[model samples]
Target: MSWHLFVVFFASTFFISATPGPNMLLAFQYGLNYGVKRTLWTLAGLSLGLFILLLSTLLGLDVISRQSPWLLTVIKTIGALYLIYLGISSWRDTNNSSLMSDASAMSAEVSAELTPNPDRSAKPLPRSLSSAAVKSVPNDWILFRTGMWVSLSNPKAILFFAAFFPKFINFSAPLWPQYIMLTVGLFLSETIWQLIYTIGGKKLAGWLDVGERLAWLNRGCGVIFILIAAALIVDVISTL
Candidate 1:
């Protein structure tokens, strides 16, 4: 592929990746709950899942769709159901503790430690005890798996890749090298936007630290997930 073509492809993908989707929503939600350092695992998982979809499309998803269309429908149905499960899980997760509360607790603990206390014999509460109200953080593996499954829960992405990539591909050129270049370009775009969403979520969490705003934000994400799942189901029914 020529430089001009690659540039165009990159531009198109950058805009496409910027669109808010399930993957971005996950990154945002995880970033708000877990912070940026841990959210890296989720981002990695998202990349892997997206890579698999792209690879499957390039390898033979088009042929599979033509040969076994029902299989695609089955995949979509399962994906939609999984999304509904995630949506309900998010909706039901009504943890009252916000990151701001945790920070405030820690700050208070530090202040107490710094203050001259007459009761030297009385020890300060342990860090865990002080922040006991905060929910336990999920292990890294759980975050990664959540990201992967969320990404994979939209099999329409495979169909999207199958349709979208061909417009940028050159049939006359050596295919694998072009694929590699395109993949790298697309990933670069995705990574940038994912980071943007994560950081944006973190900042939003900070602002919404008052009362139940953060909790509502999470429920809002849950509602979006269900909406996307419903749209997917509708599309599947239409195809039938």
Candidate 2:
């Protein structure tokens, strides 16, 4: 692609990425709860999801998506339902967790101390409510998977990339080199932007009162997620 086209694409993508979508929101949410360092895993998962979307688009999923609108709607509905479930769960967790056992309390205490990493056997986690099964925050891999799921679940992302990426393509030229260049640039820039949001969230966490838990933030993110889910539903309905 020409420099002018690259600039336009980069700027557009950067700004669009800056917008608080599910992926960004998840990064922000996790950043607050898990800190910037751990959030890197989540961001990595999001980037992988984006890479898959771009690759799928390049491989002509865009054509299929365009041909089958219902597929997109179904994907969107499924994504929305997932987010709605998360929102409700997050909200309820924030409230109910107020009375939760001490095991669930802490920044990353319970999760780190009790729950073994997925690589480990499940023999450790207590059945009822010991330090282990206290509704603790997830570990790194779980957060990463959460990011992947959130990104991949959003059908809007597939459609958006499908529609948006083609505009800057130089069909007359060799595709592979351009693909490599654009994907690398796009991925790196997006990663940087996501890091900023994650770091910003971490900084915000620093400002919270020492005693303040992540419950309020969880509740807030839950509401935002529900709104996003609602918006997706509204969009789907509008299409019909």
Candidate 3:
């Protein structure tokens, strides 16, 4: 791909990635519950899942879908169900007093421990509080898997990549090098936006640390997940 073409592709993808989607929502939610450091695992999983979708598309996912339409339907059904499960889980956590108490206790502990240190800053305590609140935050592997499954659940992504990549690719020339360049450019854009969402969520969590506000925010995200799942179900029914 020429520099001019690559630039155009990058620009297009940057804007597309900026749109809020399941992957970004996961990152944001995780960032609110965990910290940015823990959210990195989720980001990595999201990238790997996206890479798999893009690779599958390049390797003839379109042909596979045409030959076995039922497979896509199966995937959509499973994806929607998984999204609903996540939504319900989030809703359940909305009134989790233990989590809030743990976070508040940890915040007090950190403050007490740091009280004697004249140079210690208060900025890091919020991050510590967020992570501490969820005493049983899933391990790194679970977080990674959650992100991967969430990304992969949307079978439409394969169709999207199948349609979107061809516009930027030059089939005649050597393809592997172009694929590498394009992948890097796309990942750069995705990573930047993922971090932005994560940080934004963390900031919001800090700002909404007051009573009930954070719980309501969690509920709102749950609603968004279910809405997206409902849309997916509707699309699947329409396709059939």
Candidate 3, which segments miss by more than 4 Å at Cα?
61-135, 202-240
As a whole number from 0 to 100, the lDDT of residue 198 in candidate 3 is: 83
Q: Against the true structure, what is every candidate's RMSD?
A: 11.8, 10.3, 11.3
- Judge candidate 3 at residue 102 and give its lDDT: 45
Q: Is candidate 1 or candidate 2 better by TM-score?
A: 1
Residue-wise lDDT of candidate 1 within 11-75, one digit each (tens)? 76675565446777667655655678887998998899999888887667345455776876675
Per-residue CA lDDT of model 3 for 45-100, tens digit only, reads 88999988877766563444557767756656666776677568666765534332
Worst window of 10 by summed lDDT in candidate 2 = 98-107
Candidate order, lDDT descending: 1, 3, 2
lDDT of each: 0.67, 0.61, 0.66
Which is the better candidate, 2 or 3, if ranked by TM-score? 3
- Tell me the deviation in Å of residue 122 in model 2: 11
The total of clashing pairs for model 3 equals 0
Cα lDDT over the full model 3: 0.66
